[model samples]
Target: MASQDVVYTSTENHAGFKIDVVQYQPTKRPIEDRFSVSTKSSNRLLLGVYDGHGGSHTAEHISNILPTALLSHPPEKHAQIFRETDHTMIRAFTRDHSLLRPKSKSSDWVHHAQVVRAGCTALILDIDVNTLIASYANAGDCRAVFYPPVDAEGHLRQTEDLNAKTPSEQQRLAQEHPGEDLVVVSGRLFGRLMSTRGFGDACYKLPHGTIGNWQHRRYIDALSAVKESGKIPMNSQYHAMFHTYRTPPYLTAAPEIGTMQLQKDSFVIMATDGLWDCVSSNDAVQIVRGGLEQEVDNLAEHLLHSVRATRAPGDDVTILLLHIIHT
Candidate 1:
């Protein structure tokens, strides 16, 4: 049974399987999403949608290590791994420099895992009591959509966090740079290689160096701290200084790093760029609603079928569907 992002009068039945089909590649990878159901008081249900760019290396890296990364945290860590992983991911690009470069020793693909230059985007949803919080983090074009369920009447209702972007975000952009487009590109799935924010992408080659906020006050503060610490002499050779100090790598799709109070009528959908690029948030929500109302079987397959029907000619599609049954 699937529950929408609404507080329904009756109990909602919710259970789902994440699905994927990677096109344009010689090999089909197992889905990157990792879903687990736990009996803990929080009734932990972890669902992650990872979309990778350059190649599947980024996806594979997250698929293999994210579980371990989560394990590294004793639940008391409260997403500390998120930050550590942030550093761990960038440590490569910083240490090695050049995300577009074919990394060997430091690449997650070579030494530890078989990862490549690919960078990944992720959205994780955790279901705790009286709240179904979803973390929409990505360095690429993956996305998460929340849909609230309605009754036989076909009415619709959902959580307030459903809107995209925000006025504050616009204000923040204005504060940062006046002329720069607030929503650079459509922010649509297939447009920008790296979303406004994400995890593994390196500094993009642009006429201006404003890919995102990667080179902002945080960087200045970091540079100031490093300089003050006297790690290297101010007049030292540029090469030596660069070798000593470097900025952390960031995913194209960085999570808002948020906490939301989720109730029933909560349905969460996360998928890689392939799916989100071809499909819009509203379109995805509609498909789930339609599937549940009509056949009510193989919702994942139904989603894939719809995505295939609408997907672009050259797209690598992967999707992970989740329904938040109980808060």
Candidate 2:
């Protein structure tokens, strides 16, 4: 049975800094998106959002374990830090994918488990009060937008574009990979999935080995048979795109990382593609900045309500409104 929608809201405060969060599931699909806020110290904070594509397991697992995985490593340079963090996330995802492998399941069932082709995009932000530096890393389309303090007219100021690349940019990146075929099906990686890089999706990330040769042939044959029989409907043709044990390592978990100096009254917005799919970054910034000014404790809830009311039903929507209070 399809489950009902779920929405959650909460506030996390540390050393007078507050992180307002809202999580919403607009459709009946499982809430595959997960988020968490943690503090390394009174002056340092970490926030993350994981958007699962095939199922919630990968996202749930990342939500529960990624924070600790990150905290275990001490601070370092921006590039080194993001690289280390990405490796940690990849390891955690690989471990869980192996565990979730069903002993007797069919290829179709395994495909749905997110192990064969399921995965989640990751967006993480690290904030330091002392330096007012906000470092971010992005693996998929999940995005972060910054809204500076209001101007004389009370209009929110744009700090810079922290959002991820557009779909076209992602395709360009896919083509950059060696031996990736530069093939894009429906604007997704490998011509099948929306996210170009992320955790899990072993069939895409791992290279096909000796045993994978036969598996690859079987995979293509099965898909061909299914297509020829007209079993998959046109509207759902995307589902026919699954991963094969191809070599040369087509997909990756690497992230794009950068640092920005946060203005005194700056606030950062983080969310999954579900929310972005419906609401533009500019619209989200306006709503959230206004809410922050109004001291809206339910800002996350209000954002979800606006998204659900304004746009068509979307994927799981998760938003985090983080206000940095400089001491």
lDDT of 2 by residue, 22-90 (tens): 777766556788998887767678889988866665677667666666665643443454445445544
- Model 2 lDDT, full chain set: 0.62
Clash pairs (backbone) in predicted model 2: 114-118, 185-191
110-224: candidate 1 lDDT, tens digit per residue? 3222232334555555544334544333333456555664357644432222112334433443454445442323532112333334344332211112443333323222223
Worst 10 residues of 1 by lDDT: 1-10
lDDT, candidates in the order shown: 0.43, 0.62
* Superposed model 2: Cα runs more than 4 Å off: 1-6, 74-117, 149-182, 210-212, 215-246
After superposition, candidate 1 runs with Cα above 4 Å error: 1-42, 71-80, 92-109, 112-116, 129-139, 149-196, 202-254, 261-265, 310-313, 325-327
TM-score of each: 0.55, 0.73
Best by TM-score: 2
